[model samples]
Target: MNNLNYGIIGNCQSAALISEKGSIDWCCLPIFDSASVFAKLLDDKKGGSLSFKLTDDYRISQEYLWQTNILSTTYDNGVDAFQVIDFMPRYQQKDGSYYTPPDIIRFIRLLKGKPQFSIQYDPRLEYGSSKVFTTIEEEYIYSQTKDGKYDSLFLYSDLNYEDIVNQKTITLTSNAYLLVSYHEKLSQQSIDRCYLKFQRTKTYWMDWSEKTTSYPIYQNEIIRSALTLKVLSYEKSGAVLAAATTSLPETIGEVRNWDYRFCWIRDASMVIKVIADLGHPLSARKFLQFVIDTIPDKDEKIQIMYGINGERDLTESFLDHLDGYKNSKPVRIGNAAYIQKQNDIYGILMEVIYRQFVEFETTLENREELWTIIKGITKIVEEH
Candidate 1:
C-alpha cells in the first residue's frame, strides 16, 4: 500500500491516494489543505484507511481511464474476480461551472466470477486523534468527529448492512456503487443522482480529453501530465498545490519528506504557463491576480509561498504520534521554507507577469493597481 501502486484522484476541493490493493490509504478530507481523515500512507496503524476488497486471494491491476483522470482498478484471482472503478466527481455543467464534490465513488462490478467482497470502513479524524462516532441508517454508514470542521461523513451504498458493524464479507450477486462522501450537503444527493453524477463525470473527463490537443506519439503521457496539473489546481482560490500528498519520505529512513500542499509563487508562475497554454487561461489569470493581491504594502517580507487561502505564517512542525512512512522518523508538516531568501521567487513571478501582459495581450481590469504592486515588488527585491 506504500508504493507507487497508488493512483491520485481529486475534484480540486479534496484529493485522495488509493492503493491498487483496494485501500484508500491517503485522503485529506473536506479540503486538500485539511488534515487527513484517512492517512494510512503516513502511519499504517494510527493513520486510518478504508478498504473495499475481495475477500479471497486476488491479483490487482489498475489504470486511469483513457485520456482522463478517472482510475479503474481490477482485482482477480483464479477462483473469482471483480473490478472497482474509482473516481472523484468533477466536471463542468450547464452553467459553465464545475461540479466538483468531495466524494469517493467506488463503482463495483462482478466481472468474471462470484467474488465475495468485504469492506473495512475505519476513519480516523483530526489526524487520528479526535474521537469519531459512527452510525448506520438504511444503507448508509455515517461517521462524525467530536469537534472537527468535518461535521460528518456518509457512505451510501446498495449493499445490505444487516451484519456489517463487525467487519465481514458479503457475497455479491449484482453490481453496485459505494460513495464515501464528506459533509451533509452531498449526503442529500439521492442514489439516482449519485449514479447520474458518475455518468456525467465519466463523460466530463472524456470530453476534456477529447478537447485537449493530441500530441504526435506521446499523447497518453501528455494528457496524464496535463490532467494532473488540472487536479492540483484549486479552483476556489486559483492556487495550485505542489502535490496532493504530504510527509511521505523521499528516501526511506531519511527525514526528507515535506508537505507540498501549498501554492508557491515560484511554482505557480510556471504552472500557470502550461495551464494557460493548454487552453485554460482562467487558472493562469486567477493565479496571477492572486499573486498580485498577496503582495505586501512595501513593508512585510513577500513570502516565497502561502496557503491556498493566503495565510502567511506557515510554521513547520513534527508529528510524533504515528510511525512515519517505512519508519522514516520525524514526519513533518507546515513547510518552513516560506521564510527562505530564495531570489527565484521574484524571477518566476516576473515571468508570470510577462505572460499575462505580453504573451496573452489581454487587458487588465486593474492595470494601474497591479503595476503599482509590481513596482513595489521590484523595490523590495532590489533592497533585500
Candidate 2:
C-alpha cells in the first residue's frame, strides 16, 4: 500500500484511526474491548468514522518511532507539507494511585508553507449499530449516546461543520499547531485535569520506554507488540482484549465471526504467561487478582469469558440493518459462547493458578477449594 498519511490515536483502552488528512476513520469506545463506535474500516455506511482530509489532493506515508508506540504520519499536498503525531498516554501506578485517561490525542504541525484541511467528526455508536446524538460546541463537537454511558467524539481544531454534514474545514499556516482530544463525560475541572494528565502520561511512556530492558532480537518489533498488548489491557481490571475490534472477520465473508470485546479466559492465561516471560511479574499478578475477583464463589463452573470489568450476561444479537464487513453476513454483538459449557475451563484455570504459584513464589490460599474440585473430578473420572 502506498503510505497514506494517517496515524492512530489510542487511549490504551480504545483507539481511533486518523488520516494525515485529519479524518478519524476508526474508533472503538468505552473500552478497548468494546465494539466499534466508528467502524468505517468495516462498512462505510453503517460503520461510522471521523475523517480529516485535505480538499486538495494529498500524498501520505506513516510509521511509528523506533521502540515507541508514537505514530507519525506525513502529508504532502504537492506544494505544502504537514505531519501528525499520534499517541495514547500510558497510565502510571504510584503512591497507590493510577494516572491515566480515556482520551486520545492528535498533535498536528505544519512542516512547510500552508495547507487547507477538512475535518469530519461522525461517530457511529455500538458497532455502527446506533446513531449518535451530536451537539455542536464552540470549539469542539460533542457526540454522546442516548443512554449516556459512553461519551465520545470531541474534535479540537479550527474547523466548523458545514451544512449539518458533521464536518469542518480549516486552513493551516506554516508552524501552526492543533491538538484534538476525545473523551467521555468530563467536568470542566476534569477536562483541565486531563489536559495536564496528558503531559504526565507522555512522560510516563517515554520514561518507561527508556527503562525497557533489551531483548535478544527484533527489539523494535517486540517493543511495539508489547505496547500494543499493553494498550489492549484494561488498567482498571488488568484484563486484556483479544483485539481492538470485534466482527472484523478472521476470514472475511465467513460465518466464523465472533464478538471479541470480552475477556477470554484462554487469552488471559496466554497474557499472563507472556507478561511473566517478559519479566513483568506485577502485571501478571494484577491479572491474576482480576480473575480471582471476578470469579464467583457460588458456582464452580467457570465462565469462558467476561466483560472487561468482569461483567456477566452479555446477550448476543445481530445488527441486521447494517451490512457486515465486506458483506460477510450478520454483524453480531455480545457473545453467545459464554453460555456454552466448556469442560476444559476448570482445567485451564487450575493450571494457570498452579503456574502463577510456581512462577511468583506464592501460595494458593484456596488450595482446599481447588483440591475439593479436583477430587470431585477424579471421582467422576473413575466412575466413568
Candidate 3:
C-alpha cells in the first residue's frame, strides 16, 4: 500500500517530503509554488526521486531530532549500520535577518561496521515535463532541463559522482555529506561548512521551540504542531501556505485534489489566530502584514486564496502526464478556487484583525491602515 508515511523538512521558503525509507518523493525548489524538483509522490513512474538504496537485510527506522525539524533515518543490518540525516538550512544571520536557503542537506554517518548503500539521484525537472540533463563538474553536479521551460538544480557531495550517477554501491567508511541546491553557490561547498550549517539550524529550531509557550498538557504535541505551522510560514512575504502540495486526491479515485501551496485569507487568518494563541506573535504579525500587502486597495475584492508572495491570480491547470497519487488521474497545478468568493472571509479577517488590535500595540500609521481595512471590511459585509 502507498502510504503517506513521510516526514517533512523545510526552511520555510520550500519544503520536501521524505518517505520513511529516506526517499525525497515530493519537493519544489526556490519557492513553494515552483515546479517540482523531485516528485515521485505524484507519479511513481515519471516523477523522479533522490533516495538511498539499501539491501533487503537492512532494517530502516525514521524520526525527527528532538525539538528540531531535522529528520534522521537509520539503516541497520545486524553487522552494519548507518544513518542519513536530512535537513534544510534555516537560521538567523548576524544582521538579525534569517538565512533560509532553498537547499536540502543529507549527512551520512557510519554508525557501526562498514555499511553499504547506493545513491539514486534521478531528478525530473519542471513537474516531470522536461528531460533533465546532468553534468558532473569539479565543484558540483549540475542538472538542468534540456527542453521546454528552463530549470536547474545542483548537487554537491564528497561521494563519488560517477558512483552516484551509475548507482554503484558505496561502502561507508566515515561521515559524508550531500547538498542539494536550487541556486549555484559562490562559496566553496565542503563537509565542514555542512556540519556548521547543521549545528546552526539545530540550534535555531531548539531556540524557536523554547520560545513557544508550552502547556502543562500536550506540551510535546503543541511544540510539534507549532513547529509545523512555523515551517509553513514564508519568510520573504510573511504568507502562510495552506499546504505544500498540489493534486493529491482526498479519497481514492476522486478529483477533489487542488493546489494548496498558496495562502487563503480564511485559512491564513485562522492560522494567525492559532499562532498568536500559542505565543508566537511574530508569525501572526507577519501574516497580518501579508494580508495588508495582498489587498492594498481598500475597495478591492478579496481573493479566496493568493500565492505565497501575495500573487492575486491563481490559475488552475492539469499536469496530464503525471499518473497522480495511486493512479488518480488529472493531476493539477494552481488553484481555481482563488476566483471563488467566500462571504465568511471578511468576518474571519475581522476576527484576526480584532485579536491583533487587542493583544498588541501598533504604530500610528499601521493602526490607521488597519482601521481603514476594518472600515472596508465592514462596508463590504454590509453591502452583501
Leading candidate by lDDT: 3
Candidate 3 residue lDDT tens string, 1-384: 347888999999999999999999999999889999999999988999999998899999999999899999999999999999999999999899889889999998889999988999999999999999999888899999979999999999999999998899999999999999999999998889999999999999999999888788999988888888888989999999999888888886788887899998888888888888877887877888888888889888778889999888788889999999988877898888888889888887888888778887666777778888898888888898
Model 3 misplacement above 4 A: none
Residue by residue across 254-308, what tens digits does model 1's lDDT show? 8888989898888877888877777776677788767666764656577789988
Clashes of 2: 10
Clashing pairs in 1: none
The 10-residue segment of model 2 with minimum total lDDT is 158-167
Query: Which sections of candidate 1 miss by over 4 Å?
Result: 147-151, 185-191, 296-300, 361-363
> Best to worst by lDDT, what's the order?
3, 1, 2
Provide the lowest-lDDT 10-residue window in model 3.
360-369
Please give the RMSD of candidate 2 to the true structure: 4.4
* Global lDDT of model 1: 0.78
Best by TM-score: 3
The number of clashing residue pairs in each candidate reads 0, 10, 0
What's the lDDT for all of these models? 0.78, 0.63, 0.90
lDDT of 1 at 194: 65
lDDT of 1 at 230: 82
